[model samples]
Target: MGNLKSVALLLLFTFFVLHLPFVESDWFINYHIHVTNDLPLLNSPPNQPNLFLHCKSKKKDLGERPMVKGQDYTWDTKVNFWRTTLFFCRASWVGRKTIRFDAFVADRDEMTCRHYHNSCMWSVREKGIYFSKNNATWGNMYPW
Candidate 1:
């Protein structure tokens, strides 16, 4: 009986060790986020309408970045262990009112991003901000 108990314990330990990587990999996925300026180009030389963005989470602050028409900014991050990870961005331009929107909320984006291989794409246009999982189909998420 003692020998049988030891063997069972050893087998359980081995099983757990072998499966640890798979478990961690599933829980610690890194998601990619893309932000693009899709606004029409302004012909003005010195007063070009440039998009300014500041993105942040509770633990990280991505500093303000300036983007011209057709420019893109991207970053990769992991969801927190508690599954409450959230990222929000503030957008501004030459004449429009500054707007704030949530870029990534774990509960909202986890399944959608997983379906697209962990990618979330956002486009900033004159009308509003758009979101897409595959970049082929976009939905208006926030209006400007």
Candidate 2:
């Protein structure tokens, strides 16, 4: 009886030790991409001027999402195209038009890591790089 009890305890300990790895494996690193901009609709060739881009991410973890945050923002410009320049969050104030966008990511414990920083940029065409025209107020046009 004593021998059997010891064997059972050993097996349980082994099983628990193995389970620890699976739990710790949750420690993973991922990234997110977001874009925002507003371009006044110029009455010309493209009536409803909209921007689009064929984006590819170097990191498999980072993908594309509409607008991470969609409550407090507006579209000042009519035509715009944005892509992932880096991972940005809605915490830092870059300029007037460009505000920080928050990204909600999870870690090992499922704790939310919100508001990474301005890590994204506009596509080469959108020109979200200048940081000059980024002084417009947020209108109703968010994450389009």
Candidate 3:
């Protein structure tokens, strides 16, 4: 009986060790959005829109934590903007898609969030700009 117990313990330990890597295989990706409020130009003419961003996406490293404004401030942008792009990856779409975005700031305001939010902001980590209006309308540019 003692020998049987020892064998079972050893087997369990081996099983856990072997599956450790597989259990944690899910890697994380971060995304950021750089937006220039341009509140100053809010009153500017429509042609010369005041609202502008440094670029599209701006990626950063935040270990494995969710992206947050005050917590995660280390930005990665080639062009400067008003609010720094920030984000982190998380499981989404019922585990189908690995969604990544700024923890604090969203792509668009509350009203437009559901339909066209992701497109409005850029993903820093993914290095891509998102636009709800037309996903294909954005220009190809490195995340700054």
Candidates 1 and 3 compared: the better one by lDDT is: 1
Candidate 1: lDDT over CA atoms?
Answer: 0.84
- Between candidates 1 and 2, name the one with more favorable lDDT: 1
Tens-digit lDDT track of model 1 for 77-105: 87775679899999996566689999999
Q: CA lDDT of 93 in candidate 1? A: 69
The superposed Cα distance between candidate 3 and the true structure at residue 61, in angstroms, equals: 14
lDDT of each: 0.84, 0.30, 0.34
Per-residue alpha-carbon lDDT of candidate 2 for residues 1-144, written as tens digits (9 for 90 to 100):
999999999998997687654344322323223343234323323333233222232333333222321212221111111222222333221122333332322221122211233122232112232221123322232232
Pick out the ten consecutive residues of candidate 2 with the lowest summed lDDT. Answer: 71-80
lDDT of 3 by residue, 1-144 (tens): 999999999998997687654334311112232322212222344444222122223454434323221122223322123334334333122112243344334323322322343223333223232333333344423332
Model 2 alpha-carbon drift over 4 Å, by segment: 1-27, 44-49, 58-144
- The candidate maximizing TM-score is 1
**TM-score: which is higher, 1 or 2?**
1
> What is the lDDT for 129 in model 1?
94
By lDDT, highest first, what's the ranking?
1, 3, 2
Model 3, global lDDT: 0.34
